[model samples]
Target: MSEIPDAQPFTPVSDVGEFGLIDKMKAALADAADARDLVAGIGDDAAVYRVGAAGSDGPSRVHVITTDALVEGVHFDRTYVPLRALGWKAIAVNVSDVAAMNARPRFATVALGLPNNLSVEGAEALYTGMAQACERYGLAVVGGDVTASARLTLSVTVVGEAEERAVVYRRGAQPGDLLCVTGDLGSAAAGLRVLLAGKDRMTAGDGAADDPPQPDLTGFAYAVERQLMPQARLDRIEAWAEAGVRPSSLIDVSDGLASEAHHLSQAGTVGAVIDAGLLPVHVQTALAAQRFDERAEAFVLYGGEDYELLFTIPEAEASKLSPDTYAVVGQVVEPKEGVALRLPDGNRVPLEAAGFRHV
Candidate 1:
């Protein structure tokens, strides 16, 4: 008898990475739903669908939907990250996605996977934290499901609304558009670095009986808070609306400056050059980077979870934005030029997505 054929090997997700897997899923689900009312289905900060308003003959308003999940070991550690902060962050992250689409987040639903060892009070504290964040962002927590799990997990979904014409995507950037970002970058990453250092100190037997020595966070409070709870840049979206200016393309900076820049460039089939000198780094963030003996620019480039908005706008609209809140860091270019980072010394290097990756 002929020998049996060898079993087929399966592909690991890491081979193609997080975005590659998303691209594969996007292709497979292209025809899964009707396309008539779908504004944007996949490969965006949020999914937008068109729906008519009640008793209105005017243009349909679009609903933006987004979801994000936080896993215990992967996203946080209870030893340093408080449950309340975790809860607030869970909701804020999804809101950031909606804001990235230039929509106003109105409601949210939370799905939780609870570990059996957790206490009822612990769960309630989490919800309380979520409620606090909801109050601040003007979001209502609807309903969701709960189930047992090996570790604690929280998944938040947000729904937002906007006029059909107000929605922005990541594919409309032109060669002359200016690249901008709201607020400073890398502060959240610096915060995480501070928290992790504290954790290491505690675990290394640096505490007295019944009391432990904590990391001296006197000057790093801003960085620490940024890591534990980061606010979404919804204010920038509101500012744009008030000024009657819209970005040609928009994305939230959850995956660092370099990665998000590449995203905008690839989405628009254009090229970009990020000026290293123009990147805005917070004072506290720079201090944290120095404390860790790391380059401040590295933090700004590769620090994920900033939750700031990264976008491209026409030169005419750039003047309308407040200089205090926004910074023009680069310019869009032809596709042949690709993406590059112009160093302060005038040297240029290819800008790649070396930010956070799921895989």
Candidate 2:
């Protein structure tokens, strides 16, 4: 064989503007495999899908719906996030919203805007991740739209169904209700710190000439995994219903516990007092935060993306809940008092709103 000339190294994606990148992405995914349930896919004003008729049990089953958007650079970093994780995250976040409403997610429509820099193979990898999430959650990607855009963007709308009288909302809490949440908080935030530090180390090229040991990432890995593939609390919601436990109010911790507590307080026209000592912080989360020189307590209070359910139950019925699945974090008080954090030392402090925001 003849000798071949060497080609120049590939440039990074940042060289191209956002819109130009999207155009390249569109061209790459031009031949997506056909999906039968997709009435529309990858190019339309909105995707359309068909849902089966309501069962004969009652009036047409009520549809529970929610939408969430993930933007490159804002919600995720293309460099560190594997394509599969990215796809899973896009769907998982939407599913969490549906679970927050105490509904079973059944269908989802994913709309994507691609930049030209991404290859068809890369897009397929992303779809593979999304498909895995759908299977895991018992949801179907019934339809979606694909289009060229300035940047990589994934917008997902999930449709769910719940019995007419079973859907929960955020505005129903009353005074004397017991506030609760599923799972521990702060792991995702701790994971983010580890990721950032790892990125910095890699960029700095501070490794030994021989072979430096890889950084310990166990704690961060769990946190990052939680952020990437958070499971919806649908199982717990169903169990609560079966046990005859109805929440007086409900909301999800898309934001941190502190912010969500304020949300429930404002919506229900009541104040809340959360015991700081009772806030759940996973061991991994605490360790990760310590490695990053961050306060573990602060992370639990204000670090977002836990996605656990925050709800209220009548004081009398709170005892019926299984402690393994839920924790009584606080109590509802009259509105004029405002939300507060009762300290371990028997002092109280005003609860400030702290959580993630796009802008």
Candidate 3:
């Protein structure tokens, strides 16, 4: 007798989404889980572990590891993105995860796949950007791999070290804590809009979101630059330590404020209320928004790639943080209240995680 034919075609990964895919993978491997030394696994920014007598400082030391990848057609485009900036961005993304853990980045290993079109100079420019990032973030590039591929890809793995107690987790937010963010939001998204518009004009009015053009980038210079070369707020991480302020919970805003805030609150089993008026938007972001005939606030809440820190702290410590360093944009509320956002005109609504999607 013939066997039954397949019941259905394979499901598209997009349907599950990035985080959903991660959960599926973790669950598939859950049976082999070893939890003794694993402080955190697949759910957060980085993996945290209890390091033993290895870090010079002995048992109190904890280790964190995070990896990030940038691909030509997926994570970036060749049209307006500079190779150097892309390199810096790849490093910044991984380092941002380390910062989320409130850990000091110590070392990184890069594995890059180069296309035939990239010249020695192009490769050098990319490495230079990564070098700058490493120096700025106090990290060393110990080793890496270089390979040839049809498309360019850069994968960076970062290792960070910190005292076990100093490491922040996304699950520690308390109901009375204040919601905080470092630096401004929405600038990068504005810049991406400018680039896309320029490309469309170059393609003779086709608005397809691919291809390249050396578009006049002065429309919103700062916003465009932010899209290409964003910083990872490492200095602010240092300052938080300097002030002796340990955030009750922490995350980096790579996906966008809305998505990140939801992630943090859900992980912590709490809720948040974001004040729309309290979000700090850069001047260039506003200008870019007007040029595109869009609301500036949209980018602030939903634009991804700001790479800023989203955290929560006790009200007492929150009061001590300077406004220049931290913006208390909201407060953790009871889980019964749910995650909500307060608009400028005094309307409150559910905080939706409707931001950039990687899948």
Which candidate ranks first by lDDT, i.e. highest? 1
Q: Single out the weakest 10-residue window by summed lDDT for candidate 3.
A: 205-214
Model 2: ten consecutive residues of lowest lDDT: 39-48
Clashing pairs in 3: none
Best by TM-score: 1
TM-score of 2: 0.81
lDDT of 1 by residue, 124-169 (tens): 8899889988988889998878999999999999999999899999
Candidate 2 Cα outliers beyond 4 Å, as residue runs: 1-60, 206-215
TM-score of each: 0.95, 0.81, 0.92
**What lDDT score goes with residue 34 in model 1?**
82
**Candidate 2: RMSD over Cα atoms?**
11.6
Q: How high a TM-score does candidate 1 get?
A: 0.95
lDDT digits (tens) for residues 1-359 of candidate 2: 97787988897766764434755765677577454433323321122332446355544345667778888988888767778888988887887777776777899999999989878888898899899989988899999899987778999999877665666677678889998999988887777777777777665666554554344575466787776667667778788887887787787887788888887886448999999888888888888877777898777788888888899889777777776989889899999778989999989898887576543
C-alpha lDDT of residue 129 in model 1: 84
Better of 2 and 3 by lDDT: 3
Model 1 misplaced stretches (Cα beyond 4 Å): 1-8, 53-55, 206-210
Please report, as a residue range, the 10-residue window in candidate 1 with the lowest summed lDDT.
205-214
